[model samples]
Target: MNAVVFGAVLCAGVAAWVLCARDEAVRRARTLLVGPWGPPGPGCGVPGLRRLDVRVQALLEPFRVRFGWRLGRELLCLPAGLVLSVAAHSAVPAVLAAGAVPLVGRWLRGRESRALAEERALAAGALCSAVAGDLRAGLAPQGALAGALLREGWPGRPALADAALPLLAAARFGGDVPAALRTAARLDGAQGLAGVAACWQVAVDGGAGLADGLDRIAAALRSERDQREDLRTQLAAPRSTVLMLALLPLFGLVLGAGLGADPVGTLLRTPFGLGCLAAGGLLEWAGLAWTARIVRTAEAS
Candidate 1:
């Protein structure tokens, strides 16, 4: 009798979920067709819910760009938490899992920032080489810069190309090329371009050989890139150690289960076990955060 009731309840829940999803889809379609100001839409009846939805979308925008399909994994946290809550008949694990979503998003953002920095470094080096080659070929500074912009397959090509627009404009109009370069350097993933701007200013103002200056800059950038690579290599062992330590608890849990200890049951059914789980999770999070901070500091230096 209990099994029949449970099955019926599960079927009912699934049916309701499907209905709700269908309704949401239809409402979204209507809103898209009619526009925001058309008629009242889903969540429009509740101002607070609407505001909260907006805030969540804003928060997720950056993560969506960085993680792509991986961002969907974060949304699974809520449902996974609910499943654990049902399986263990406890809410604690569910809440903890749900709370982890933000942390995961933050980690993804950090990875994106690091990648952008590396790309910018590469772009700076490529720009230096291109400019130096152009100068050697007897191209004017403006022509050299334009040619570099047209060159393909560089790490930060998109950003450099955008920066090149204002730069080319300045060069053509006999405006301040140095100032334009500095302005472009302020864009995201273009910080390294400031050095290029400085080199250009010195070459132009001090009557130095621009090609030689660019060559020197390219060499320095290449050396810096090598140093960064070495630093990452040195940090790999510590990162692996931290990851292995974090997984040790899972191994212990699995080992207990294999020994017929019903570790999962105990964790979900007993207050003491639940407390241990939460405490362990908190410690794991803290340790990961600390290790990450140390690594970031090393990278920044």
Candidate 2:
């Protein structure tokens, strides 16, 4: 009976999650296509879903600063963990799982930020190269920068666009282009823009060769990008090792089940099993955290 109920609840939860996720995606897609904040589409326009989204968003508002706009999605783990605890007939694991969700979300957000920085870094290099070409073709510095940014041949245009907005505005309005570049440089992966700003400042102040300086900066960024790619390849081994180790607990459960043992019932109903589960989970979390820190340290260096 418990198994049947758990199965039904899980099915319902999965269905709801899928439908909600699809609606959100569709709404976002439509909004993008319309080139503005268009009306919500289909399921998203339903009051129940709309209110559910708003209420969930409100609940997660306090966490918005740390997690950005994705806190609501992370909070879904709470109900998921609850459903799992129901199946396991355990509240302790559920509580721990809920608590870990935010930390896990934070870790994921950091990884995403790092990846975005890499994209922006590559985009910055492309922008600099294009700007140099435009300048050599006799375009004004502002025109060169604008044309380079507006081009659609690059992979990281969205990231580049976000980082270059201030620079673009300054160029268009004649509002201290070097200062704008410096502001854009504050974004992750946009450190190259600082060099570009320095070159611009020199050109503006002393008539130094801006094109030549930009070319050098672009070359340096490309070299750094290539080195990062090589380093990532080297780092993949440790990442894969950590992932496999993390899955060992699940593998153990599968093996136990294959041996005709009631592992789930044993873990959920017995005190000794619960204690072991708690200890093992804590150690697993610690191991992952420690390995992640080491990888981040290596990446930073």
Candidate 3:
């Protein structure tokens, strides 16, 4: 009777999932957020998969705006949890997975954000170096900035793209270049803009060597990037340890099954086993979350 009830529940969940796949409301929302076609995907040639991907992204756009990128992506766990519940023939593991999704996404999100920040820092250094080179090549300060900004893409530093319009207007139309740089500095990973602003101001006011100041700023940014990279490398061992500890229970289950213990059956079918499973899952989750919080706090500081 229990098995039959579980089967019925799983079937209902799957049917709902399928209905959602072709829902007009979902499609309408996707269209409203992402437009008629979708955002440009790679030339991967998988149109159907790519379309679905874009639609999810469209739906999650608000989540992304409201929260950050990490939670927005992690919110997919609501449906993913249902899928897991359906697959496992039990709800315990699915509930555990749903609860653990944030902890799961945290390390990955931190790594991605750190890498992007490092790239942005490197790009900032490159920008400063380019401007310095142009300055030494007989261009005025404004002309040097203009030449630097004209370089395509800005290379892994899309955040800097925000500054382009204001910087251009200032450079070309006698607006306050230093002020623009300072404003741009307010962006994450672009704090070097503040240094550039100070340099520009000193050069304009005190007749200091702008090229020399810019070269120093570029070198400092590069050094900061290297320091961050080294720090991440040092932290890798602890990250691996934490991740391994989190997966140890799965290893234990595999070992038990190899030793002829029906661990899976016990956990799924027995009340006491289910309680232990829930308790163990929560402990694992809390441990991961706590460690992740510490790591993030350290990184922030």
Q: Which candidate has the highest lDDT of all?
A: 2
Judging by TM-score, tell me the better candidate of 1 and 3.
3
Best by TM-score: 2
Q: 248-296, model 3: which lDDT tens digit per residue?
A: 8877866876787777668877998888887887898799879978877
Q: Encode model 1's per-residue lDDT on 235-301: one tens digit a residue.
A: 9999999979987886786687667677776776788987887788789879988998999899889
Over all chains combined, what TM-score does candidate 2 have? 0.77
TM-scores for candidates 1 onward, in order: 0.71, 0.77, 0.72
Runs of candidate 3 with Cα error greater than 4 angstroms are 1-52, 59-72, 97-116, 155-157, 293-301
Instruction: Give the worst 10-residue stretch by lDDT in candidate 1.
Output: 18-27
Model 3: which residue pairs collide? none
Instruction: Give the per-residue lDDT of model 2 (tens digit) for 177-271.
Output: 88888888888888889999999999999999899999999999999988888889999998999989998887787677677787776776799
Give the poorly placed runs of model 1, Cα more than 4 Å off. 1-73, 153-164, 171-175
**Residue-pair clashes per candidate:** 0, 0, 0
- Runs in model 2 deviating more than 4 A are 1-70, 152-162
**Candidate 3 lDDT for residue 246:** 88
